[model samples]
Target: MNNSLDQESSRVNFYIRNWLLGILFIISVVGLVALIAPPNTNDSMGYHMPRVMHWIQNQSVRHFPTNYTAQLFLSPWSTFTILHFQILSGSDRFANLVQWFAMIGSIIGVSLIAKQLGANRYGQAFTSVFCATIPMGILQGSSTQNDYTVAFWLVCLVYYILLSLQDETGKHYVLPIGVSLALATFAKPTAYLYSFPFLLWLFIVKVKLLRWQIYQPALQLAMLVFAVNGFHWVRNFQVFRNPLGTSPDYIIYTNRAFSIPIVISNIIKNLALDISTPVPSVNRLLLNVISGIHELIGADINDPRTSSSNFQLNSLINQEDLAGNAIHLLLIFTAIAILGLSWKKKNFNYSLLNYILCIIAGFIVFCMLLAWTPFHTRLHLSLFVLSSAFVGAVLSKQWSLKVVNLVATILLISSLFWLFFNETRPLVANSNLLKTGRVENLFIKSRTYWYFVGRPYFRESMIGATKFIKSQQCTDIGISFNKLDIYEYPLWVLLNADTDKKYRIQHVAVKNVSEVKQNLEPFKRFNPCIIFDSSGIIFEKIPEQKGNYEQKWFLSPVSVLVKTKN
Candidate 1:
């Protein structure tokens, strides 16, 4: 036993000494430190964390009245994990940790897939680091977003699928594959695109082989998926009469009908945006191409009607630094180069190649059938991960040692540079850390920096409004905003933390001050102590009665209407 333990320890030490492994360790430590900082992402503060808080308060996952349609309808598996951590810690200090851990899990799952695909230790290390260094992955991994969480589950499903294919007794692995698929689907609806094709292939192959025994395990798999994710769909059906809660046409509609040219144009634009970098010339060129394509398709690129569909492309042109996965184009080109060089090699695994092609084909079909959004790169995360494994395998076999080392060095440097000085606010600000001796002090200083220096007016308004709400000692508050569900995080966090179990806060959706006045009718019975508007709107009694309501400006733009009389 001692000899075996010593051998294992020595193996670990040997791997740690490798240059690539050392770089990976450094990068991971940086991610861990970033995870400790408070989550400040818009979606997280707006709905992700708030939804978890709501579930914890209710002590169940039942549907509730919410102005944020997404908060009530989106899959909650990722939030379930966040809820556990929030409940355990009694704070959101670890909210981003869930995504960070998912990043780590994805790395492990990618490494396993590379190994199964015939990559050596160095190749596996390269694959792990390559996936980890993606700018968007790191950014999302350090937030409360569900994309990375679902990506991790997708990687695991692929890994398990490969294992089951290799196993002589496939029945034993069906349960795990089923569980992984269920979890992946539950994490995000996009998982169906990533996992369903492979599942169908598995079933077809089994049928051809006349493996009737596998049917029982397949049924078990179905049962497991239904057990885990069925409730959410059932609830959606009950409430919206549509299992998905929103129709595909409603979600992805536009003035122009869906056509082949539009689909191709959208896919190209999505790819361009996904691989865009901080470089100005590249961004300008990509934006021009996208705009020109829109013109050819009879769509006015800048029209408000097209903004929602083209929002990502517009944002990319406006904010070039918002590029995702800086190495994506490089990864694709390298994979192509490697495959071309190895074309003469007679020992290629055609089965694996066919399977990967099917997965990619399914993803493209899924995207075409859904909407044309430039942010669809996030939906392509599983493809990126799978491509990394193939890239690793090809590099391990075709590339020379010197070439591999050079590529590793460049990737490591690029990853570190992005981690430290990328346009996106890093997890840890070096200047803040240098100024503060303790982590808590750094967090405080960082929050103040972000609130005052980074986002300035908007963040300050949120903080000021939260402080004012706490001071008012309101037992119940009603919040309304122009955007309906977003930018309510500050109030939710503060009000929930202030009272133990005696506060109720409800969100009312309204478009303008007139709508706000109209919506207050339903809440008047509850007599909300305060009505907070983050949209810079002011309210007065409709009849101009004195002393019925008092309005005060918490921030110049943010106002609170207090009810002094019923």
Candidate 2:
């Protein structure tokens, strides 16, 4: 019996080692891609990187007048991370790696959370593998998006909260819990919805922790959150009249109606989003079923009041914004079903159950408040990441060693497709090496080549405009984009704004809600010798300026307005 027990322990150790090795390999590959790729996701191009550029240009994180109000008001913690790196490095070269580091941290953090739920070495390491392989996590792990960063902080928050609940000797976790809360809150608004239930669960579990001897930690937590978010909140209130910055953009994304039917419709659609697959027929079938359920409940499938965007079952692309974790979703459902059906046979684990309950509540809260957008899979990243811990704990208890290994293998195999072929920043199909036959293809210097690989027309327009401005020896350039989601960061990059301090780009014609602040210095005093207008709005002269700024060149969607003294 003693010999057999030793062998069993040795086997588990070997499996743990293997799992850890697989996780490291995945991380290394994704980290390489993250380091190689330029930040070019639609949202990154639209506002994420653009906001960082503005903050760098202005030397402050204050609200700025522009067509994209999101760049002004969205949480700044993620950009804060980017800004720190950019300022220290003197370029945006390290931007994508921010999310990459978050991915690594989240993987490790979830394993700790798993251990707190009574998982042994094998189970804890398994949690790391599970997180490392999430399709959405893998896709966003290599981009400049905040989802993974917020997910990392939330993972730390959940782990620290559990530690505080379980700790009997001292209050070491209090500081970390507070810090994680502050960081997560400052990272994204979705953190509020996701963190609420877990915090409530912690309070319910230990109400005495709020008393005199321990109340200091709670107060510290509150102070930390306030300290991290206070300045930004004040700025938002001063500009938008709401600390949360409730603009028409946010209002439209919020569900306009509140009813059980709308909630149910949202819940179903949101869950279905995670299970979306690459097969068009299967996606259509899923859509039909979702639509049928909505009809039965007397709700519109594509209700503008309920959906933030046109509802579509898209599964063709493996985009960071749209990739869903179908394999992990199936694994989670299987674990839940097994645990529910067999709980009577197994010992009751209240901690795991409470954790799962809180996650479920978080999901319901998310569906209740926010309108369904196709990119919601990205928003659901935290919930998916938290679910990884639950899946690890439950599966470790229910499945045998062989079955656990099989599941892990399946997850790792399925994730490789996304890891190599991410739609925006691919490692394989990009073929940058063969085309250039140089090391630059996989480095920061080759960013422009990789950034413009697919969007040739947009690339041509931006590059052409930048070259034209340089030829005319213009330093102060004006830019106008009609849409809020236009690509503006590439212009700054192409013009060498980071390296050359001579280039100064400003919003030429401001007409958005953010324009209320245009009376301020930069907006008021920005005069340009030339303008790049992607808005396609032709004008005889620059707005609010008197001159013969005739349209000299038209390049597809972009037009050049050169100022001429008459």
Candidate number of the best TM-score: 2
Model 1 alpha-carbon drift over 4 Å, by segment: 1-16, 170-172, 211-215, 247-257, 290-321, 340-345, 422-444, 448-456, 496-502, 509-526, 536-549, 554-556
| TM-score, per-candidate, Cα-based | 0.83, 0.93
Per residue, candidate 2 scores C-alpha lDDT tens digits across 375-480 of: 8999989988998899998899778988898888888887888877776677765334445654333443456856654455688778787777777767888888
> lDDT: which candidate is best?
2
- lDDT tens digits, residue span 1-566, model 1: 99998975675445435655744664575466455556665566666777886677567676555545566567788889989888898887777778778888887788788888888877787777677766566556666778888888888888887887766774447778888989998998878777777777777767766577767868888999999888998877665666656532334423244556655655565566676654567677878877788777765554433223544443332111244554655765677666666566788765446555656676666545555555555566667766677777667667765576667667666666556532224434433343464332234455434312323465667676766767776777777664533565666665666556466676544332223323333433455677777654434223342355577656755677787855
Q: How many residue pairs clash in each candidate at the backbone level?
A: 0, 0
Error of 2 at 358 (Å): 0.7
